[model samples]
Target: MLWGKNIYRLSCISSGMSLFSNLMYISFIYSISAKNSDSDAQGLVHPIRDPRLLSGVRPGITSSQGTSLQGSYYLRNSYLRHNLKENQTGVPLFLTISVTDTNSCSPIENALVELWGANNHGLYSGFSKSGSPSSDCSSWLRGAMETDSEGLAKFETLYPGQEENRSLHLYAIIRTDWYEHSKNQTVDSDSSHNAAAIVQIFFPDSLNHQVLNRTDYKITGRQFVKNKQDFIFSSGQGVLKAKAELPKSSICGGVQAHVQISVDAHASQNITVTESPYQCKTNCKAYQNTTEQTTTISATSKHKPHFIPLAVIFFASTYVFYG
Candidate 1:
């Protein structure tokens, strides 16, 4: 009986040592995973400041410089009157725009927010310019909405793909007093009443990389410009950049981007609108004419399993049994 008890004690000691070793290994893995998660969160929250700005490089585009010719194509007829979220391809982007008064720092209600961007293939909906190669007048990733009493406007669109000499961006024209305009009305310098700030909203480079690497955007090739290398992005001074985050409970596995645009409601910036020579006029058609539908995608939760505590409890119970 004494010999049998000695062998049992030895076996329990050996088992406890093995359990302790596994606990240490698990702890090390959890620590490393936590560190990596923290690093990723930091990157999402705080993007790197443009290096060109630090070098005293003047921006090619200034706030007072107004809108670019490329942005001028956002006319009343360019987009459909239906929901922009309908029949869209690529990863979904839940974009929210908050319009505020620069002078009062208060929300600007009833403001018209028009948003336009390229599709997954880096093609604009209505234009046939060098970079935007659509001739069918198909309106895919473009729409307009009015701000609510809280000065918020939301749109569901696809993540824009890259174009030549430009980083991924969304063109917006916010107007304080929007009136019934002709179908030929284009956002221009003379249309000051309908144009408050014609700004381009940008995304973080890290976020851009993750989205663009997906299957839908990957076929566009790798010959696109980075935010730092792009002249317009360098000149914008990061004020127009959007804050991107993962949705807390998104049925769609895409990103949520938000940007608060502060504009002088009373003042009108002179935005030049030049006609594109390559503009497509014939065979113009809307992408989808069916009834609007909202599609939701389920995302897998990233929460880690609570196994450590259970492991500790089991180890304690084992030790007590042996004691």
Candidate 2:
């Protein structure tokens, strides 16, 4: 259910409203702004609720390194990065991308996008695993946005830090549609599910590179280049491209990188899927109609105000328990 050089951000929810089931209601939120030409959101599973499993293997890439990043100068974070627990409103570094369909290259407007990233300290906001308190907003670094006709999605946040040599990276999830030609095809097919791809955005000339020596890491910005020449973008080109432009300090305060993502037209608005439910399948490879039945009893000579009776019954039950 995954492939290619995509800024991947997948989430899988189970049935109902259980703690894990929240993913089911996520359908309304499946949209994203892609940075490359190949951004998409077509998964084999009709309702992909298990993100970790359906998200494919975490590519064989080295982790993020922080040495080269320490000595580097981040104008925006010059005063914001160190022990930021005291600060309330962190500078918002806007991360925006436009997503498109690969086959037709048209912008898939109104597509849902969700993103999650670490803070300047390489720690996720509002999480204990990244050294931030559970009540902190760091975990909230993740965000969601719908694409415009131009297939653009944007977010305002801060530059993530390089902690414990863990590389700074961003994860994204985009939702689109499948082309009719791809209907009935297996999820394993490369072109079968084309709406979504796992992509990695790296700091091309990051100061951390020099301080961390992450050149050996697989997911490092260095690995993004195939021949150590190209920006290491994946085959078929990405819909968006990102850059860091930290402005001058003083009247401008600290420097901040401007990440601009230009979407590719070829990869947008084309629904590519084999044997979709809307098409009415008879001999489709991936077909399943899950339904459940429940029975209910109604009171005869029904009275009005059902809530009053229910409240009385609840009060009686509570009284019995306490008495």
Candidate 3:
């Protein structure tokens, strides 16, 4: 149902909470130094200023058929344990979301905070198929939960991997009481509810360095990319730095980091806009699924590819139903 300026086409595009005993969670990251390669950190992150500059991305790698940025398909607890074997390879990443009213600094209690990100190997769950209209959308890395009374929502998941030339990051949607439902909700021109905010939480390049090169992360023999090269940042404003704790095991130590997000408590409905990263170079490869054949697509080169600027797609389409 795409009716462009002169042509036509079609396209399309999570939550919960719990109260806290003031609970403190853990992110069991290993502090191993990465060996493959290096780059200077950008350390640049910006708030979503224009809502129509829409880009909902899952790397668009296997999705030449396109994907809905509004991936509210699964809303599980903080522990996103859908695939047991893949979950085992992941580290314990404790994600804490602290929600507050920007002007008041008061905690926004019971806010719905939904989060999703790529796994340690750079593939998202449920939608990794490379064929047209990808089926088998079961996954482990995407989930949603309600914030506790303290305005915090915590998740236990794996560290995300890198793709393209960008640094690793997580995507989230924060909603006030009226904006909680991502799948069926909409914001009006004269909004009566608070607008939703789509955000990306970037991990520090230093920590990303250590994590990406881990034996579990898979990609080897080459250098890892840093913040300086990520497409989302004009610089490195969104990189979250990591803090190390005492070692819990022989392989790695316990590490943690926390981030605070401000959601507008008032209204001005916003469509999640996106800024698609410049397309990457193509390299062909083949693989097999347990019961069938499948293809994995990538825009990467032998060496890490650099990002270029593309005219941002500022359209406002959630998702059109197929049937």
Q: In lDDT terms, which candidate is top?
A: 1
How does model 1 fare in lDDT? 0.60
Instruction: Give residue 216's lDDT in candidate 3 (0 to 100).
Output: 74
lDDT of 2 by residue, 176-217 (tens): 431111232212223223324334455544533432342222
Task: Quote the RMSD, in angstroms, for model 1.
Answer: 22.0
Q: Tell me the whole-model lDDT of each prediction, alpha carbons only.
A: 0.60, 0.35, 0.43
In candidate 3, stretches whose alpha carbon ends up further than 4 angstroms from where it belongs are: 1-88, 178-195, 220-223, 235-254, 273-323
Per model, state how many residue pairs clash. Answer: 1, 84, 24
Q: In candidate 1, what are the lDDT values of residues 1-323, reduced to their tens digit?
A: 99999899888887777776677777777767665654322212111122211111111224445545245456443342325655658778889999987888888776767788888777776664443433546566777776777789988888888776678898887766432222222221222223556778899888777777767786544665678887878876423889999767642487888999987755543333334444454554332111111011111123222335556746675774565
lDDT per residue for candidate 3 within 13-38, as digits (tens), equals: 11011111111111111111111111
Candidate 2 runs further than 4 Å off: 1-91, 129-138, 177-195, 206-241, 250-323
Candidate 1 Cα errors over 4 Å, as ranges: 1-64, 67-73, 78-82, 128-134, 181-194, 237-239, 248-252, 272-275, 282-323
